[model samples]
Target: MIGLVLAAGAGRRLRPYTDTLPKALVPIDAETTVLDLTLANYAEVGITEVAIVVGYAAETVASRVKGFEERYGVHLELVHNDKAETWNNAYSLWCARDLLTNGVMLANGDTVHPASVQHTLLDARGDGRQIVLALDTVKKLADEEMKVIWSESAGIERITKLMDPASATGEYIGVTLIEPTAAADLTDALRVTWERDPHLYYEDGYQVLVDKGFRIDVAPIGTVDWVEIDNHDDLDRAREIVCPS
Candidate 1:
Protein backbone atom coordinates (compact mmCIF):
# COMPACT_ATOMS: atom_id res chain seq x y z
CA MET A 1 0.00 0.00 0.00
CA ILE A 2 1.05 3.58 -0.64
CA GLY A 3 0.72 6.67 1.53
CA LEU A 4 -1.64 9.50 0.52
CA VAL A 5 -2.16 13.04 1.81
CA LEU A 6 -4.90 15.49 0.81
CA ALA A 7 -3.27 18.91 1.11
CA ALA A 8 -5.47 20.93 -1.19
CA GLY A 9 -8.00 23.16 0.51
CA ALA A 10 -7.43 26.89 0.98
CA GLY A 11 -7.81 27.26 4.70
CA ARG A 12 -9.38 30.72 4.64
CA ARG A 13 -9.81 30.62 8.42
CA LEU A 14 -6.02 30.39 8.83
CA ARG A 15 -5.46 33.31 6.37
CA PRO A 16 -2.13 35.22 6.13
CA TYR A 17 -0.14 31.98 6.19
CA THR A 18 -2.51 30.19 3.79
CA ASP A 19 -2.52 33.32 1.63
CA THR A 20 1.02 32.50 0.59
CA LEU A 21 1.12 28.80 1.43
CA PRO A 22 -1.29 25.93 2.00
CA LYS A 23 -2.19 25.02 5.56
CA ALA A 24 0.06 21.96 5.38
CA LEU A 25 3.02 24.25 4.80
CA VAL A 26 2.23 26.43 7.81
CA PRO A 27 4.81 25.72 10.50
CA ILE A 28 3.90 24.15 13.80
CA ASP A 29 7.47 24.26 15.08
CA ALA A 30 10.08 26.75 13.91
CA GLU A 31 10.71 24.91 10.64
CA THR A 32 8.70 21.72 10.71
CA THR A 33 5.24 21.83 9.17
CA VAL A 34 2.15 19.63 9.38
CA LEU A 35 3.12 18.07 6.05
CA ASP A 36 6.63 17.52 7.39
CA LEU A 37 5.30 15.65 10.39
CA THR A 38 2.95 13.60 8.20
CA LEU A 39 5.72 12.54 5.80
CA ALA A 40 7.97 11.74 8.73
CA ASN A 41 5.31 9.51 10.23
CA TYR A 42 4.77 7.73 6.91
CA ALA A 43 8.48 7.21 6.42
CA GLU A 44 8.86 6.01 9.99
CA VAL A 45 6.29 3.30 9.21
CA GLY A 46 8.26 2.27 6.11
CA ILE A 47 5.84 3.79 3.59
CA THR A 48 8.28 5.28 1.08
CA GLU A 49 6.09 5.93 -1.96
CA VAL A 50 3.67 8.76 -1.14
CA ALA A 51 1.02 10.62 -3.14
CA ILE A 52 0.03 14.16 -2.20
CA VAL A 53 -3.08 15.85 -3.67
CA VAL A 54 -2.35 19.53 -4.05
CA GLY A 55 -4.28 22.55 -5.35
CA TYR A 56 -4.33 25.86 -3.49
CA ALA A 57 -0.77 27.16 -3.47
CA ALA A 58 0.20 23.87 -5.07
CA GLU A 59 3.38 25.49 -6.32
CA THR A 60 4.66 25.87 -2.78
CA VAL A 61 4.35 22.16 -2.14
CA ALA A 62 5.76 21.39 -5.59
CA SER A 63 8.88 23.44 -4.86
CA ARG A 64 9.45 21.50 -1.65
CA VAL A 65 8.87 18.05 -3.19
CA LYS A 66 12.52 17.17 -3.65
CA GLY A 67 13.44 18.64 -0.29
CA PHE A 68 10.66 16.69 1.42
CA GLU A 69 11.86 13.46 -0.17
CA GLU A 70 15.50 14.13 0.72
CA ARG A 71 14.61 14.94 4.33
CA TYR A 72 12.07 12.16 4.94
CA GLY A 73 13.70 9.51 2.73
CA VAL A 74 10.48 8.90 0.85
CA HIS A 75 9.49 9.26 -2.81
CA LEU A 76 6.77 11.89 -3.23
CA GLU A 77 4.38 12.14 -6.17
CA LEU A 78 1.98 15.06 -6.35
CA VAL A 79 -1.59 14.77 -7.64
CA HIS A 80 -3.24 17.99 -8.75
CA ASN A 81 -6.80 18.84 -7.70
CA ASP A 82 -7.99 21.55 -10.05
CA LYS A 83 -11.18 22.15 -8.08
CA ALA A 84 -9.49 22.43 -4.72
CA GLU A 85 -10.38 26.09 -4.27
CA THR A 86 -13.84 25.68 -5.76
CA TRP A 87 -14.89 22.42 -4.08
CA ASN A 88 -14.42 20.51 -0.86
CA ASN A 89 -12.10 17.54 -0.21
CA ALA A 90 -14.52 15.02 -1.68
CA TYR A 91 -13.23 16.14 -5.05
CA SER A 92 -9.69 16.57 -3.82
CA LEU A 93 -9.72 12.90 -2.85
CA TRP A 94 -11.36 11.93 -6.13
CA CYS A 95 -8.53 13.68 -7.94
CA ALA A 96 -6.16 11.07 -6.53
CA ARG A 97 -8.41 8.20 -7.63
CA ASP A 98 -6.02 7.17 -10.38
CA LEU A 99 -2.95 7.20 -8.11
CA LEU A 100 -4.44 5.38 -5.12
CA THR A 101 -5.10 1.94 -6.59
CA ASN A 102 -2.77 -0.27 -4.54
CA GLY A 103 -4.45 0.67 -1.30
CA VAL A 104 -3.36 3.69 0.76
CA MET A 105 -2.70 4.99 4.23
CA LEU A 106 -4.52 8.27 3.65
CA ALA A 107 -4.22 11.22 6.00
CA ASN A 108 -5.44 14.77 5.99
CA GLY A 109 -2.43 17.07 5.56
CA ASP A 110 -3.91 19.46 8.14
CA THR A 111 -3.63 16.97 11.03
CA VAL A 112 -0.60 16.53 13.31
CA HIS A 113 -0.02 13.09 14.73
CA PRO A 114 2.93 10.86 15.60
CA ALA A 115 3.96 7.59 13.98
CA SER A 116 2.03 5.60 16.55
CA VAL A 117 -1.30 6.48 14.96
CA GLN A 118 0.06 5.29 11.65
CA HIS A 119 1.17 2.08 13.33
CA THR A 120 -2.29 1.56 14.77
CA LEU A 121 -3.96 1.56 11.35
CA LEU A 122 -1.19 -0.49 9.73
CA ASP A 123 -1.48 -3.06 12.50
CA ALA A 124 -5.21 -3.29 11.94
CA ARG A 125 -4.66 -3.84 8.23
CA GLY A 126 -2.08 -6.47 9.01
CA ASP A 127 -4.72 -8.30 11.03
CA GLY A 128 -6.86 -8.57 7.85
CA ARG A 129 -9.27 -5.70 8.41
CA GLN A 130 -9.70 -4.42 4.85
CA ILE A 131 -11.06 -0.95 5.50
CA VAL A 132 -9.38 0.62 8.52
CA LEU A 133 -9.78 3.97 10.23
CA ALA A 134 -7.72 5.66 12.94
CA LEU A 135 -10.13 7.03 15.50
CA ASP A 136 -9.68 9.21 18.57
CA THR A 137 -12.23 7.82 20.97
CA VAL A 138 -10.72 9.58 23.95
CA LYS A 139 -11.00 13.14 22.72
CA LYS A 140 -14.12 15.16 23.42
CA LEU A 141 -16.00 16.13 20.26
CA ALA A 142 -16.98 19.59 19.08
CA ASP A 143 -19.59 20.40 16.45
CA GLU A 144 -17.03 20.95 13.75
CA GLU A 145 -15.25 17.68 14.42
CA MET A 146 -15.92 14.79 12.01
CA LYS A 147 -17.81 12.53 14.34
CA VAL A 148 -18.54 8.80 14.15
CA ILE A 149 -21.00 6.43 15.75
CA TRP A 150 -20.10 2.86 16.72
CA SER A 151 -21.23 0.07 14.42
CA GLU A 152 -23.32 -2.77 15.77
CA SER A 153 -20.62 -5.23 14.78
CA ALA A 154 -17.33 -3.30 14.77
CA GLY A 155 -15.61 -0.22 13.33
CA ILE A 156 -17.62 2.85 12.28
CA GLU A 157 -21.03 2.37 10.72
CA ARG A 158 -21.58 6.07 10.18
CA ILE A 159 -19.29 9.14 10.02
CA THR A 160 -20.28 12.73 9.27
CA LYS A 161 -19.82 16.38 10.27
CA LEU A 162 -23.56 16.92 10.74
CA MET A 163 -23.96 14.30 13.47
CA ASP A 164 -24.87 15.52 16.95
CA PRO A 165 -21.67 15.67 18.98
CA ALA A 166 -23.47 14.15 21.95
CA SER A 167 -24.28 10.93 20.07
CA ALA A 168 -20.86 10.48 18.52
CA THR A 169 -18.74 7.61 19.72
CA GLY A 170 -15.55 9.43 18.76
CA GLU A 171 -13.83 11.53 16.11
CA TYR A 172 -12.69 9.98 12.83
CA ILE A 173 -9.12 11.21 12.97
CA GLY A 174 -8.80 11.60 9.15
CA VAL A 175 -6.45 8.63 8.86
CA THR A 176 -7.74 5.63 6.95
CA LEU A 177 -6.37 2.46 5.40
CA ILE A 178 -8.27 1.67 2.22
CA GLU A 179 -7.22 -1.77 1.05
CA PRO A 180 -6.87 -2.36 -2.68
CA THR A 181 -10.19 -4.17 -2.86
CA ALA A 182 -12.02 -1.28 -1.25
CA ALA A 183 -10.27 1.45 -3.23
CA ALA A 184 -12.55 0.96 -6.23
CA ASP A 185 -15.66 1.33 -4.13
CA LEU A 186 -14.15 4.32 -2.36
CA THR A 187 -13.42 5.97 -5.68
CA ASP A 188 -16.95 5.34 -6.88
CA ALA A 189 -18.44 6.65 -3.66
CA LEU A 190 -16.26 9.75 -3.77
CA ARG A 191 -17.51 10.43 -7.28
CA VAL A 192 -21.12 10.13 -6.18
CA THR A 193 -20.52 12.52 -3.27
CA TRP A 194 -18.82 15.13 -5.42
CA GLU A 195 -21.32 14.87 -8.30
CA ARG A 196 -24.24 15.17 -5.86
CA ASP A 197 -22.73 18.19 -4.14
CA PRO A 198 -19.37 19.88 -4.58
CA HIS A 199 -19.40 20.91 -0.90
CA LEU A 200 -19.56 17.40 0.63
CA TYR A 201 -16.56 16.10 2.54
CA TYR A 202 -14.67 12.88 1.77
CA GLU A 203 -16.20 11.32 4.88
CA ASP A 204 -19.46 11.32 2.94
CA GLY A 205 -17.74 8.92 0.55
CA TYR A 206 -17.33 6.50 3.43
CA GLN A 207 -21.01 6.85 4.20
CA VAL A 208 -21.88 5.95 0.61
CA LEU A 209 -19.69 2.87 0.83
CA VAL A 210 -21.53 1.86 4.00
CA ASP A 211 -24.85 2.22 2.22
CA LYS A 212 -23.47 -0.18 -0.39
CA GLY A 213 -22.52 -2.67 2.40
CA PHE A 214 -18.87 -2.12 3.18
CA ARG A 215 -17.37 -2.80 6.60
CA ILE A 216 -14.90 -0.24 7.90
CA ASP A 217 -13.13 -1.07 11.15
CA VAL A 218 -11.60 1.41 13.56
CA ALA A 219 -8.33 1.47 15.46
CA PRO A 220 -8.52 3.92 18.32
CA ILE A 221 -5.31 5.77 19.16
CA GLY A 222 -6.19 5.93 22.82
CA THR A 223 -5.33 9.23 24.52
CA VAL A 224 -2.40 9.88 22.23
CA ASP A 225 -2.08 13.54 21.33
CA TRP A 226 -2.95 14.75 17.83
CA VAL A 227 -4.33 17.99 16.45
CA GLU A 228 -6.17 19.08 13.28
CA ILE A 229 -5.17 22.62 12.37
CA ASP A 230 -8.09 24.71 11.21
CA ASN A 231 -8.19 28.25 12.59
CA HIS A 232 -5.65 30.25 14.61
CA ASP A 233 -6.82 28.61 17.81
CA ASP A 234 -6.20 25.12 16.38
CA LEU A 235 -2.76 26.24 15.24
CA ASP A 236 -1.92 27.19 18.82
CA ARG A 237 -3.19 23.81 20.03
CA ALA A 238 -1.12 22.09 17.35
CA ARG A 239 2.00 23.93 18.49
CA GLU A 240 1.31 22.89 22.06
CA ILE A 241 0.69 19.28 21.12
CA VAL A 242 3.51 18.90 18.60
CA CYS A 243 6.26 21.46 19.25
CA PRO A 244 5.82 21.81 23.03
CA SER A 245 8.61 24.31 23.52
Candidate 2:
Protein backbone atom coordinates (compact mmCIF):
# COMPACT_ATOMS: atom_id res chain seq x y z
CA MET A 1 0.00 0.00 0.00
CA ILE A 2 1.11 3.54 -0.75
CA GLY A 3 0.83 6.55 1.57
CA LEU A 4 -1.64 9.39 0.98
CA VAL A 5 -1.82 12.86 2.54
CA LEU A 6 -4.68 15.34 2.35
CA ALA A 7 -2.95 18.70 2.59
CA ALA A 8 -5.46 20.83 0.74
CA GLY A 9 -7.00 22.77 3.63
CA ALA A 10 -6.16 26.49 3.85
CA GLY A 11 -5.80 26.45 7.65
CA ARG A 12 -6.73 30.14 7.84
CA ARG A 13 -6.52 30.11 11.61
CA LEU A 14 -2.77 29.53 11.37
CA ARG A 15 -2.50 32.97 9.77
CA PRO A 16 1.10 34.13 9.22
CA TYR A 17 2.51 30.64 9.10
CA THR A 18 -0.02 29.55 6.46
CA ASP A 19 -0.06 32.89 4.69
CA THR A 20 2.61 31.68 2.27
CA LEU A 21 2.85 27.99 3.04
CA PRO A 22 0.31 25.22 3.53
CA LYS A 23 -0.36 23.88 7.02
CA ALA A 24 1.68 20.78 6.12
CA LEU A 25 4.68 23.02 5.65
CA VAL A 26 4.40 24.65 9.06
CA PRO A 27 7.69 24.17 10.93
CA ILE A 28 7.79 21.59 13.66
CA ASP A 29 11.46 22.29 14.30
CA ALA A 30 14.26 24.22 12.62
CA GLU A 31 14.73 21.57 9.92
CA THR A 32 11.48 19.60 9.93
CA THR A 33 7.83 20.23 9.12
CA VAL A 34 4.52 18.50 9.72
CA LEU A 35 4.63 17.08 6.18
CA ASP A 36 8.28 16.13 6.64
CA LEU A 37 7.46 14.03 9.69
CA THR A 38 4.49 12.42 7.94
CA LEU A 39 6.61 11.39 4.97
CA ALA A 40 9.37 10.14 7.23
CA ASN A 41 6.88 8.07 9.20
CA TYR A 42 5.52 6.52 5.99
CA ALA A 43 9.04 5.82 4.79
CA GLU A 44 9.86 4.14 8.07
CA VAL A 45 6.95 1.76 7.56
CA GLY A 46 8.23 0.76 4.08
CA ILE A 47 5.87 2.99 2.11
CA THR A 48 8.09 4.57 -0.55
CA GLU A 49 5.56 6.14 -2.90
CA VAL A 50 3.35 8.84 -1.37
CA ALA A 51 0.62 10.95 -3.00
CA ILE A 52 -0.15 14.36 -1.51
CA VAL A 53 -3.32 16.34 -2.26
CA VAL A 54 -2.36 20.03 -2.53
CA GLY A 55 -4.64 23.02 -2.97
CA TYR A 56 -4.23 26.34 -1.17
CA ALA A 57 -0.65 27.61 -1.43
CA ALA A 58 -0.05 24.64 -3.69
CA GLU A 59 2.95 26.37 -5.21
CA THR A 60 4.80 26.34 -1.92
CA VAL A 61 4.44 22.60 -1.53
CA ALA A 62 5.21 22.11 -5.20
CA SER A 63 8.56 23.88 -4.92
CA ARG A 64 9.57 21.68 -2.00
CA VAL A 65 8.57 18.36 -3.62
CA LYS A 66 12.03 17.46 -4.85
CA GLY A 67 13.66 18.48 -1.60
CA PHE A 68 11.15 16.42 0.36
CA GLU A 69 11.67 13.41 -1.94
CA GLU A 70 15.46 13.54 -1.54
CA ARG A 71 15.22 14.10 2.20
CA TYR A 72 12.75 11.29 2.86
CA GLY A 73 14.01 8.95 0.09
CA VAL A 74 10.43 8.57 -1.14
CA HIS A 75 8.80 9.27 -4.49
CA LEU A 76 6.19 12.03 -4.32
CA GLU A 77 3.10 12.48 -6.49
CA LEU A 78 1.20 15.73 -6.17
CA VAL A 79 -2.56 15.73 -6.69
CA HIS A 80 -4.12 19.10 -7.39
CA ASN A 81 -7.35 20.03 -5.62
CA ASP A 82 -8.80 22.98 -7.52
CA LYS A 83 -11.69 23.47 -5.13
CA ALA A 84 -9.59 23.46 -1.99
CA GLU A 85 -10.07 27.12 -1.18
CA THR A 86 -13.85 27.01 -1.53
CA TRP A 87 -14.79 23.40 -0.79
CA ASN A 88 -13.91 21.37 2.25
CA ASN A 89 -11.78 18.19 2.40
CA ALA A 90 -14.44 15.86 1.05
CA TYR A 91 -13.76 17.16 -2.43
CA SER A 92 -10.05 17.43 -1.77
CA LEU A 93 -9.94 13.72 -0.95
CA TRP A 94 -12.15 12.77 -3.87
CA CYS A 95 -9.82 14.56 -6.25
CA ALA A 96 -7.30 11.83 -5.51
CA ARG A 97 -9.71 8.95 -6.05
CA ASP A 98 -7.79 7.62 -9.03
CA LEU A 99 -4.67 7.18 -6.92
CA LEU A 100 -6.63 5.40 -4.21
CA THR A 101 -7.13 2.37 -6.47
CA ASN A 102 -4.53 0.58 -4.41
CA GLY A 103 -4.58 0.27 -0.66
CA VAL A 104 -3.57 3.52 1.04
CA MET A 105 -2.83 4.77 4.51
CA LEU A 106 -4.25 8.32 4.51
CA ALA A 107 -2.99 11.01 6.86
CA ASN A 108 -4.15 14.55 7.37
CA GLY A 109 -1.35 16.98 6.59
CA ASP A 110 -2.27 19.17 9.58
CA THR A 111 -1.72 16.39 12.10
CA VAL A 112 1.61 16.04 13.92
CA HIS A 113 1.96 12.55 15.28
CA PRO A 114 4.56 9.90 16.12
CA ALA A 115 5.61 7.02 13.86
CA SER A 116 4.05 4.65 16.39
CA VAL A 117 0.61 5.72 15.21
CA GLN A 118 1.44 4.51 11.70
CA HIS A 119 2.87 1.32 13.11
CA THR A 120 -0.36 0.73 15.01
CA LEU A 121 -2.46 1.00 11.87
CA LEU A 122 -0.15 -1.25 9.89
CA ASP A 123 -0.29 -3.92 12.56
CA ALA A 124 -4.06 -3.64 12.88
CA ARG A 125 -4.56 -4.07 9.13
CA GLY A 126 -3.64 -7.75 9.53
CA ASP A 127 -7.06 -8.34 11.09
CA GLY A 128 -8.73 -8.02 7.66
CA ARG A 129 -10.69 -4.84 8.36
CA GLN A 130 -11.58 -3.00 5.15
CA ILE A 131 -11.17 0.41 6.76
CA VAL A 132 -9.07 0.88 9.87
CA LEU A 133 -9.20 4.25 11.60
CA ALA A 134 -6.70 5.39 14.21
CA LEU A 135 -8.67 6.33 17.28
CA ASP A 136 -7.54 8.05 20.46
CA THR A 137 -9.50 6.53 23.28
CA VAL A 138 -7.29 8.26 25.80
CA LYS A 139 -7.95 11.84 24.75
CA LYS A 140 -10.66 13.83 26.48
CA LEU A 141 -13.34 14.36 23.86
CA ALA A 142 -14.78 17.78 23.07
CA ASP A 143 -17.17 19.15 20.46
CA GLU A 144 -14.28 20.09 18.20
CA GLU A 145 -13.00 16.55 17.96
CA MET A 146 -14.04 14.09 15.23
CA LYS A 147 -15.81 11.78 17.62
CA VAL A 148 -16.81 8.13 17.13
CA ILE A 149 -19.33 5.76 18.62
CA TRP A 150 -18.47 2.08 18.17
CA SER A 151 -18.69 -1.42 19.51
CA GLU A 152 -16.59 -4.53 19.06
CA SER A 153 -19.36 -6.27 17.18
CA ALA A 154 -20.84 -3.34 15.25
CA GLY A 155 -17.59 -1.53 14.51
CA ILE A 156 -18.18 2.23 14.06
CA GLU A 157 -21.80 3.24 14.38
CA ARG A 158 -21.13 6.94 13.84
CA ILE A 159 -18.24 9.35 13.22
CA THR A 160 -18.84 13.08 13.26
CA LYS A 161 -17.92 16.37 14.96
CA LEU A 162 -21.55 17.13 15.80
CA MET A 163 -21.94 14.05 18.01
CA ASP A 164 -22.29 14.45 21.76
CA PRO A 165 -18.81 14.39 23.26
CA ALA A 166 -20.09 12.71 26.41
CA SER A 167 -21.35 9.73 24.41
CA ALA A 168 -18.41 9.34 22.04
CA THR A 169 -16.08 6.40 22.38
CA GLY A 170 -13.02 8.33 21.19
CA GLU A 171 -11.57 10.83 18.73
CA TYR A 172 -10.32 9.79 15.28
CA ILE A 173 -6.70 10.90 15.11
CA GLY A 174 -6.64 11.70 11.34
CA VAL A 175 -5.11 8.46 10.17
CA THR A 176 -6.88 5.72 8.25
CA LEU A 177 -5.95 2.46 6.55
CA ILE A 178 -8.03 1.85 3.44
CA GLU A 179 -7.83 -1.55 1.87
CA PRO A 180 -7.92 -1.73 -1.93
CA THR A 181 -11.25 -3.51 -1.82
CA ALA A 182 -12.93 -0.53 -0.21
CA ALA A 183 -11.35 2.19 -2.34
CA ALA A 184 -14.05 2.48 -5.00
CA ASP A 185 -16.83 2.60 -2.44
CA LEU A 186 -14.98 5.17 -0.35
CA THR A 187 -14.36 7.35 -3.37
CA ASP A 188 -18.02 7.22 -4.31
CA ALA A 189 -19.02 7.98 -0.73
CA LEU A 190 -16.75 11.02 -0.66
CA ARG A 191 -18.15 12.22 -3.97
CA VAL A 192 -21.67 11.95 -2.62
CA THR A 193 -20.72 13.71 0.60
CA TRP A 194 -19.16 16.69 -1.17
CA GLU A 195 -21.90 16.91 -3.81
CA ARG A 196 -24.49 17.02 -1.02
CA ASP A 197 -22.63 19.83 0.74
CA PRO A 198 -19.40 21.36 -0.46
CA HIS A 199 -18.48 22.21 3.15
CA LEU A 200 -18.56 18.70 4.53
CA TYR A 201 -15.42 17.09 5.97
CA TYR A 202 -14.02 13.75 4.71
CA GLU A 203 -14.98 12.23 8.04
CA ASP A 204 -18.55 12.83 6.95
CA GLY A 205 -17.78 10.54 4.03
CA TYR A 206 -16.68 7.89 6.51
CA GLN A 207 -20.06 8.28 8.17
CA VAL A 208 -21.65 7.66 4.81
CA LEU A 209 -19.63 4.49 4.47
CA VAL A 210 -20.75 3.28 7.88
CA ASP A 211 -24.36 3.95 7.00
CA LYS A 212 -23.89 1.78 3.92
CA GLY A 213 -22.75 -1.23 6.00
CA PHE A 214 -19.04 -0.90 5.44
CA ARG A 215 -16.97 -3.04 7.81
CA ILE A 216 -14.97 -0.27 9.42
CA ASP A 217 -12.91 -0.84 12.55
CA VAL A 218 -11.06 1.46 14.89
CA ALA A 219 -7.59 0.85 16.25
CA PRO A 220 -6.75 2.77 19.39
CA ILE A 221 -3.36 4.48 19.23
CA GLY A 222 -2.96 3.79 22.91
CA THR A 223 -1.36 6.80 24.60
CA VAL A 224 0.38 9.10 22.15
CA ASP A 225 1.26 12.77 22.16
CA TRP A 226 -0.20 14.16 18.93
CA VAL A 227 -1.91 17.34 17.77
CA GLU A 228 -4.01 18.38 14.80
CA ILE A 229 -2.81 21.91 14.01
CA ASP A 230 -5.98 23.81 13.32
CA ASN A 231 -5.19 27.12 15.06
CA HIS A 232 -2.30 28.92 16.72
CA ASP A 233 -2.93 27.17 20.01
CA ASP A 234 -2.86 23.79 18.27
CA LEU A 235 0.38 24.79 16.55
CA ASP A 236 1.91 25.63 19.92
CA ARG A 237 0.79 22.29 21.32
CA ALA A 238 2.21 20.42 18.31
CA ARG A 239 5.55 22.15 18.66
CA GLU A 240 5.64 21.27 22.33
CA ILE A 241 4.88 17.62 21.61
CA VAL A 242 7.05 17.31 18.51
CA CYS A 243 9.95 19.69 19.23
CA PRO A 244 9.75 20.37 22.93
CA SER A 245 11.83 23.12 24.63
Candidate 2 residue-pair clash tally: 0
State the local distance difference test value for candidate 1.
0.90
lDDT by residue for model 1 (22-116), tens: 99999887889999999999999999999999999999999999999999999999999998999999999999998667889999999989899
**In terms of lDDT, which candidate is strongest?**
2
lDDT per residue (tens digit) for residues 94-156 in model 2? 998997878999999999999999999999976668999999999998889999999999999
**What TM-score, computed on C-alpha atoms, does each candidate reach?**
0.97, 0.98
Candidate 2 stretches with Cα past 4 Å from truth are: none
User: What C-alpha lDDT do the candidate models reach, one value each?
Assistant: 0.90, 0.92
The best candidate by TM-score is: 2
Candidate 1: regions farther than 4 A off = 126-128, 152-154
Q: List the residue pairs that clash in candidate 1.
A: none
Weakest lDDT window of 10 consecutive positions for candidate 1: 149-158
